[model samples]
Target: MIRSASQGMREGRPLSSSQAPLNVVGEEAQSRPGSGQPAGTTQLLLLVSLAHLISHVYILALPPLFPFLRDRLQVGFVELGLALTVFNVVSAVAQAPIGFLVDRIGARRVLAAGLGLGGLALLSIGLVGTYPWLLFGAALTGLANAAFHPADYALLSAGIPKTQLGRAFSLHTFAGYLGTAIAPAVLIGLALLGGPGLALGVVGLAGVLLVGLILPMRVPAAQDGADARRRPAGSPTAAGGSIVTPAIVSLTVFFTLLSFSTGAIQNFSVAALVGGYGITLAQANAVLTAFLMLSAFGVLVGGFLADRTRRHGDVAAVAFALTALLTLLVAVADLGPVVLMAVMGAAGFLSGVIAPSRDMMVQAAAPPGGSGRVFGIVSTGFNIGGALGPLLFGWILDHEAPRWVFGAAVGFMVLTVVVALRDRWLAQRNSGAGTRGG
Candidate 1:
């Protein structure tokens, strides 16, 4: 029973065959129960993945280029380290406001601005020669990096079905990691071909140009935006969104600890191997590659697992425990480079499992139409921890001992476990009341 658009021309007119199936599927998709994704979600995922890849292309390139940056600018360890530290600090703090902007303006504009501006910031880092000017460039880089999540995650929340979020997040994380993993190997060789500084500068130029090209690209329409404007005033995702419920607030604390832990791993792992374990920089970087490669794999697999998982939080908790044990093991164990690399690989694998599940948890908890702001706020934890972890760990390595770095990381893990246990207990209490969503 379908009414064709052309049926008005004549009641006797035969209906086009294509109209029948289109009506059936469209009606079925619209009628399906629950908060589900749109058909456009798959394309959005591709675009998001590409955006992540581009963003991380810069990230992966940065660590290896630190040597070049140091020599070219004639700066010391403190200066170079501070540049990165400040970058993350600025980037982390800005996410909340950026999130707010995305909520009002839309993801299309924010996404375009972040990537496009990020490209400009990077290009300046290359063109600028003075130490003070270079620091300015780093600040700009931070701002550019800070702008991506709110818009990207918001699009994801509205377009994709809640159940499929794990896979989407995993794809996002994996794409970024893949970009990071490729940077050192590819860019380093390119740097060798010309000059390191020249290579980096050229790469940045390409990124800027690419962003300019991409910003003008077309995007699909989002129904969520229209729906939000039509909703009653004082929705949870509006004013009520600001207040995190007790359990949700607790989860935020857990996210903060997780952020801190990731920061320690990302920032210090290379330096620790070099300074504490007596490994050379090249050797340490090689080990870092292992860590990132496995981490990339972990993100992809974690997403897959999360998508299939009936109990995502439990799976996340188990993953967290493994990461904790791995951190502790790294702290206490003394091993050769080969053995250490193997261990890091295992640690990376286990740690990778939590990312997708964690992202899903946040998405699930976010008040409707508030994904942009929530992602923005939560993402700050990652960047802020990025700032703190290194400064804290580097101080220990430079002054006291390398062992302290892992010990501090262990503290973060312990906090994570406590939070996870608390969440489980609350879930159990709620379960008996027949309030558990599952």
Candidate 2:
């Protein structure tokens, strides 16, 4: 259960028998942002979001430097590509196990350790500058990458006020998108100023520095500790039934489809526009950039919408249906440049709108004290989609079938709509059954 106003606490101070119990007013005063809460909820939110931003920065860091790395390290493109494949594969394999670790030990420590490990990996790559060392660094970074989703979601679930969760989640996601958007320029600029070595070194140091903020954070208790204190020994969660229910499996599919659909637009839209429609490269890139920026803005708007309505399924369904139509139009029609940009931007915004509600749906599926395991397992869909989408879309582009990119995206979006609605229905049915049983 979520902490109510009466359950709120002062910064760094847990309730003790020696102290008087807090009144609702007193607890609210301590818990509310900027009201003398220890470490402050607002501060924790920003710190966590900043960590998310840096994680994405590291994810995209090497991609922008591939050309520089090729020349500097004297390696072929295949070798560099292998580094990325290793990174994604290792991360995909490790996320779920690490999630269980988060639940068992705690999220903050795991998150801090990941940051430290990732930082050391990058620092090693910069200092060593060998292809084998690069592969080693990539593998270590992958292990570090596996830790973020599980730890970050667990932290947010435990720390943020229930009422404010939607907005908090949106901001967190927005920071990540912002990181990806900036990484190319950040890497290019750093490489140009000094070298790729300098760029990697600086980024690595940034991660190490951020650890300072995380270590001293006097945040609220994590769900693991709270659950141990609050639950009776014989509770369902204590009995340990499997967390991988049908609902969890369905949500995983939903995430995979969502990632694949969005990855198509993100990775291939510019290429498709140029190849299929005779658009200039500049025009295609402009459209893609607009799409990405508008998507980030839409996440903020969706946060407000998520807070306002409990029907996240309806929101996701309607948004996805419209997105599919727009994608199909893009597939079949050759619109003017301005019109194409506008339509793609709209599609991006709708896609972004689905994000917070998507997280909310996952949150709902997560049993208390099991958020880490649930998110760890479901978020692996991202890696699956990321790995597979590129292969399939790159093949279509290679085969000179550009319009099929949009067509495939439309198919994925339609499937997502069905899954979203079905998940919602199942959740409602379970909730109703539980209420009657009670």
What clash count goes with each model?
1, 1
After superposition, candidate 2 runs with Cα above 4 Å error:
1-39, 223-226, 434-438
Pick out the ten consecutive residues of candidate 2 with the lowest summed lDDT: 17-26
For model 1, the stretches where C-alpha displacement exceeds 4 angstroms are 1-39, 60-63, 209-224, 239-249, 274-284, 427-438
Pairs that collide in candidate 1 are 37-161
Judged by whole-model lDDT over C-alpha atoms, candidate 1 comes out at 0.69
Q: Against the unseen true structure, what C-alpha lDDT does each candidate score?
A: 0.69, 0.83
TM-score of decoy 2? 0.91
- 58-159, model 2: which lDDT tens digit per residue? 899788899999999999999999999899999999989998888777777788888889988998998899999999999999999998889888777766
Residue 162 lDDT, candidate 1, scale 0-100 = 54
Q: Which candidate is the best by TM-score?
A: 2
| Native-to-model Cα distance after best TM-score fit, residue 406 in candidate 2, in Å | 0.9
How do the predictions measure up, each by TM-score? 0.82, 0.91
Model 1 Cα lDDT, one tens digit per residue, 154-219: 776665555677888899888888877677777778767765666567667766666654454333
Give the C-alpha miss distance for residue 176 in model 1, angstroms. Answer: 1.1
